[model samples]
Target: MHIFEGFLPSPWWQVWFAISIPVIMYGIYQMNKLVSQRREIVPLLAVAGAFIFVLSSLKLPSVTGSSSHPTGTGMAAILFGPAVTSVLSVIVLLYQSLFLAHGGLTTLGANVFSMGIAGPFVAYALYKVASKAGMNFYLNVFLATAIADWVTYVVTSLQLALAFPFEGSVFASFKMFALVFATTQVPLAIMEGALTALIMKYVVQVKSDVLVGLNVLTSSAATKLREAME
Candidate 1:
């Protein structure tokens, strides 16, 4: 969800920008490192960008008298790893801002922090933890998307609260956010989780080569697939 324009007062807005500049620079640095390490990932990044572009453009009705869309960050994170996914998301968000204005320039950093950084990273972390615990892969994928998608909105809602402080009523702001956003977000999370799992399964089976190119499918995973086919 977009933070409405002019939501923040001047001083806090200035602080937000100040904090964000270094984060943006760090993202750029990380992107450059990933490109160097995995030269083939450049094309995949473009593909991921296009996928997110399409996903973000599709709007679903929200209870808040607005619409929202999937960021598709969980899939990206599962594909390229979270560090690279952050950069991927920043690029996609930039493109969306320039073309679609789905998100605003002034609030761009906050959006990046919420949707780009929090969403994919949180999901990937969940996947890793679940995998380590010997949880089923599909279940891990589902939990990843659900938690990430839910947390993204939580972060966004908190940001909105920070940006627009109500008159001495913090709980009021939180209640408003929960009422308006949670209904649509819950269903969207389930959809994103299922979609991510399907896509990942397809890639691991029919398009193992693509995952190899993305540097996501380990040699062991590839070998297991080939052996199973044999």
Candidate 2:
């Protein structure tokens, strides 16, 4: 959920900017280094960015009272890790803030932290854990993506609580926002996870080798998916 233009006040907005910049700088380095070494991955990067744009852009204000849209960061996080996913998220956020008026530049830092950094980091971590556990490929994607989606909103609610605690109780404010967000976010997360998994399945069919090379899919898993498709 976007915080909207100019919604966040002074230090809070600045503080979020402070928190997000260094990581994004690192992400810039990672992205540049990766592109320099393997320009072939450019199209995949575009696809990842497109996923962020399209899925996140479908903003549903509230379903029985919720907040925003599907973050679509999970697939990108799986494809590029949190660092590079952060880069893609900021790009999309910037575009939306400028032209789409979804979020403001002032709140970009906060938005990025929730939708980009925290969410993607969680997704990447869960994806790695599931991969190491030898979980089924699509199932791993589903769980990681869905949990990441929830975590993003959880973080968003936390941010809001921190900024404006209810009666000096951050936890109480967090509960209020989180409960409201959950109404729509729960279903949104599940839908996003399923959609991400479906997209990944098709991607595996056409670009299994590329995914394998990127370590997104184990060679064995890629082969199995290919065989299943055939």
Candidate 3:
């Protein structure tokens, strides 16, 4: 969900900017270094960014003048981790803000935090946990992507509640906002999960080596998947 432009109070937006800047910088540095070492990742990253741009741009109206949509961060987070995903998210958000007017410049940092950093980090953590548990690969992707999409909306609601406490109580506002988003977001998340799962399945079948290179699939897992594909 996008918090929209001018939704946050001035100080709140500034605070988010302060929090996001350092991480974004580090992400840029990391992405540059990684691409330099593994040029093959560049096209994958581009596709990931484009996916995010398209998915997140499709917004459904929600509470407090905000809107809900699929974050599209989970797959990228699983592939490149949250840091690089953050960089890609910011770029997508910026482009949306400029031409699409989906979000706003002042609210960019807050959007980045919720949709980029928080969601992707959670997705990565869940993916690792699912993998370590030896879960089915498709199920792991579904859980990670679905849960991450939901978490992004959760964070956005919290951000809105914080900026505008309802009846002078932030908790109440948070609940209100969360409830509003849940109406549309839940089904959207499920759909995104299914789609992401299919994409992962295709990648595992056709380019298991890419997953192996990203450490998403261990060599043994990649080999097993390739054999299954055969």
TM-score of each: 0.83, 0.90, 0.88
How well is each residue in 22-103 modelled by candidate 1, as lDDT tens digits? 6667777888887898788688678878987897787645445546677788877777677777777777877887888667
> What overall lDDT, based on C-alpha atoms, would model 3 receive against the true structure?
0.86
Question: In candidate 3, how many clashes are counted?
Answer: 0
Name the candidate that leads on TM-score. 2
Better of 2 and 3 by TM-score: 2
Q: Model 2 — TM-score against the truth?
A: 0.90
RMSD per model, one decimal: 3.2, 2.5, 3.4
**Poorest 10 consecutive residues of model 1 by lDDT?**
59-68
Q: For residues 51-146, could you state the per-residue lDDT of candidate 2 as single tens digits?
A: 679877786445455555677788789988999999999999998888778888989999999999999999999999988998988999999999
Sequence-dependent TM-score of model 1: 0.83
lDDT (Cα atoms) of all candidates against the true structure: 0.74, 0.87, 0.86
Cα lDDT tens digits, model 3, 1-230, are 77789989978999889988999999999999998998988998898799778866666444434355667788789888999999999999899889888889999999999888889999999999989999988899999999998998899999899999988999999999999878888887887788788888888887778789778989998788778777
Rate residue 226 of model 1 by lDDT: 55
